[model samples]
Structure formats: C-alpha cells, structure tokens
Target: MSQHQILSTEPKPFVKWAGGKRQLIQTIDRHIPVQFGTYFEPFLGGGAVLLHLLGKNPEMKCRVSDLNSDLVLSYVTIRDRVEELITSLQTHAKNYHKNPDSYYYGVRESEPKSQIEKVSRLLFLNRTCFNGLYRVNSKGKFNVPLGRYSNPNIVNEENLLSVSRVLQSKKIQIICRDFAAVLSDAKKGDFVYFDPPYQPVSKTASFTSYTNKDFTYEDLANLVDVSEKLSDKDCKVLHSNSNSKEVRDLFSKEWKIVEVAANRSINSDSTKRTGQKELLIKNY
Candidate 1:
C-alpha cells in the first residue's frame, strides 16, 4: 500500500478505551495485505480496527456487530443524530465537568431511559468514568467510578459527524447481535477481525467481565471453530488475544500466530500500564 494512503483519513478514536487496538493498528494493517473483498468485524468493542480500516481502505464494504446493546445504541444514535448528540454532548461537557461528582452519580441514580437521557448518561459516564472503562455489575448498573482527569474533551463534533458519514455510507451495515451471528452471513473473500475480550495471560490477570456474562474457554473454542470454518471457505480472518499458552494452543494448527506488544489498561499502577506482549493470529 502507498505511504500516503491512510494519511488523509481521519484519525482514531478520541475516547480512552480498554482493549482498544489503536496502538496495534499500524502493525495489524502491515500484516494485512491491501487486497481484499469485504470487511467484517464481530466483537466490535471500541471499533478501532473497523474505523481504521474504513479510513485506510475507502473502497471497503463493511459489516460490524457488537453484543453490547448500549454500545450499539450509542453508535446508531450517533450515526442518525450526530448533530443532536453533539449538541447534547456540549451541554453534558459544560454541566458535568462543573459538578462531576453530583452529575456523575446523579445520572447513575436517575435510571434515565429516554433517548436523550440514555445518550447523555452514556456519554457522560463514558467521558468521566475511570479510563473510559465501561464495566457493570451483575445488576447491570453503571458502576465505574469517576476518573482523575480535570478537563476532558467530552464533545467532538467533527469526529462524530465523520462516523455518521461512514455509518450512512451504503456499503456498511451495523448490527446489534451475538458476535457468532456474524459468521453466518460472511461469504468467501471477506475479511474478519475478532478483537474479543483478551483471555487472561495469568490467573491474576483474567478480568473478562465486560458484562455479567463471561467469555469462557468454551466461547474461545467456538470462535476457533468459526475461524476454521471461515478459513475453509477462503475467508481472511484475524484475531487478537493475550499471549498465554492456553490462547496460543486454541488456534495451534489452523492459525499463523505472532506476538506483539500491547498496553495493559486494567492495572491500577500507572507504571504497570506500559507495553506488554500479546498474540495476533491470522488465517493466511
């Protein structure tokens, strides 16, 4: 690919995210050759990969899905009402930053359900939450505490509008469903990228609880099955996971596994947040 290809494309996400692949995008892109048909991404967390691909490969026909309803709603709402969301986000930025403690927990207490409230609460918490980590308890509440940042850019109108343009493009389809459902519609020559919850590298490291539901070993095995089936049909597939023996062994024969560095987001100590190695498996 040309050096100038991705230069003009808009930049990556502004929001801090757990397991976000912004740092790994260039490496991932280098590994993935430019030639491909359509693009598919299941388990789309912050969608760093999809958005990066969209910017780099404008010709891509894309389909992306995620299990989180709130995430899906946020994306859809932004796609449809980006201008309105931006307006509301400006208001949120103004009000929440002024009285963060009250606004943070107030929205948490209000149990707001309407579109306005839901989007506002979602954006508010996302901006203020510690490291932008979206975690919830078994009761399904927004439980992440307020972060340390004094002034965060809560409203980014240009990026929101660009995302809306991408979503509005006829070539893309955004779905809210089980990640496995993505495999059903994927055809030959399609490219699939799975950035699922990283299987813990160590016993102490395993915190896959993005939701109440656990992404167990069984789920990993299921994903391996999906990858193999897709590979058999000549689909190009790539997955990112922790560099653990168990994760490595799961795709032992069928995948081309490579190790690369990744930032550890869950650790409490800022010093421990340095780059650590992770696994990248591709079906070539």
Candidate 2:
C-alpha cells in the first residue's frame, strides 16, 4: 500500500526458521566488512542477513546453502516457482481455514509426491505448526505441534511475490550442501557468514533437530576448524552461536567474539523464552 510498508515487508524470509537472524541483522550489519568480492552464507536458514544484504545491494552476488534438503527445496521453489507456490499455498490456506486443527495434522502427516506439493506442505506446516520451528523426528518427519495462532498468515502474497522478485533480481546461487563443504570455494575477499545451530546452553535445552541429523558438539568443533581455515585464507567470516564456554574456547584462540542479545522465542515455556546471551564470532 505504501513505500514504507513495502520496504518493511518486501523480499523478507518467506518461511519461519529456527535461529533465524532477522532480529540480529542490524547488529551484524554494523560489523559487515565495507567491501568484499562475493558473499557466501553457508548456514542459510531463513536467510535474514542474506536477503537484507541483497536487498540493500541489489547487485550483490551471493551463494547460499543449507544442509536441509526440504528447506533448500522450499527456497528453490519460492525462487523459481513463486507463482505455483502461491497457488498451492492459497489452496492450503483455503482448506486450513475451513478446519484448522484437523487440517493441520493432516497436512503435517502428508507425503507429497511433487516438489511443489512438498514445498507447499513444508510452508503450510511451518506457518501453522508450533512456533514456526523446523524440527523433525528421527525418521525425518515434521513433528512440531500446531501453533496457538487464531489466524496464521498462511499466504502472505506480497511477501512471497517480493521474495521471488529478489531471487530473480540477483545472481544468487542456491545450493543444498554441508556448511563446511560450501566454503571450499571461498576465496580471499569473499565474505562468509555462518549461522549454524547454536550450541545448547544445557543438556535439556538442546533443539538441533533441523533434519533427522543432529548438530552435536563435535559439529561445532568442526565448524570452528573451518572458521580458522577461512581466516587463514584471508576470507572474512562472521558466525553466530550460543554463548557457551565450549563455543567461546573454540574460537578464542584466533577470532573476534562479540556478545549479542537474542530472544529465545521458540520455547513452549514462556518463562524460558527471554533475552539470552549469544556470541557472534568474526575473523576480519
């Protein structure tokens, strides 16, 4: 309706993502290096920083990747098939509004045959499911319960359209790859951002079921090694993770770690969700 509203909503992250960087964009933005060659984001969750950077610099070339195939498929679908996605989402919205509770579970358990249907299922479940979390069981199934929303925005037409336009507007390369593997192509002057699953604060607080696979402590160490290597190669790196002792020690030897406050909003217990300390490590 207005330019301000359009800018506020345009080309935003289409799907809800766990540990998404939307709220931390500005804090991270101030630390983003002045100039760089290509932009590479390995842990492209909802791509808040990626989308924001691209929107501000429309010509910025980018390569984004994630380990989750379904998540990556959703991105590819929205980027290449926004029209079809909108149609499918509209259909889902129509059916969901008719009978939300029953319809939510039905869609949750559904096994779609086509890419469009698969992505539609994912987006539909994400919008309606608990807290927009992307957790799955050991069998790789979507298991988050229905969110407590009287009216979930199942089909944000304008946002989806804007996402498509932004994807089409740039030379953004989307791929499904292991986060560390994606950085092998990184060269000097390339800015790389890592938003890997945050290391858990405690044993009971772990929630890294993004796929059937788990991102364990070893995985965090492996990522630390990757960051060190990237730093050695003179590639600018920015990473975010829980502000735990293990994470700090891993990078303290050779990186800049900044404390960032982020809201832990996805927890079922409202009391547990509050401003938590997180660390954003960088190698400049």
Which candidate comes out best when scored by TM-score?
Answer: 2
What tens digits encode model 2's per-residue C-alpha lDDT throughout 1-284?
55456556647888778888888888889989999988999889898898888788878988889988888898888889988998999999999999999999998888989999999998888889888887889998888899889999988888887777778755789989998885578999999998898888888888777878889889989998888888888999988899899888887656888898888776779998787889888877
> Candidate 2, clashing residue pairs?
none
How much lDDT does each candidate structure score?
A: 0.78, 0.86
Could you give candidate 1's per-residue lDDT for residues 78-191 as a string of tens digits? Answer: 778777888888887888877988877777677766775677677777778887887878888778888887887678666666666666767888888887886788888888
Q: Please list all clashing residue pairs in model 1, or write none if there are none.
A: none
Candidate 1 TM-score, C-alpha based: 0.92
Off by over 4 Å in 2: 1-9
Question: Measured by TM-score, how close is model 2 to the native structure?
Answer: 0.95
TM-scores of the models, in the order given? 0.92, 0.95
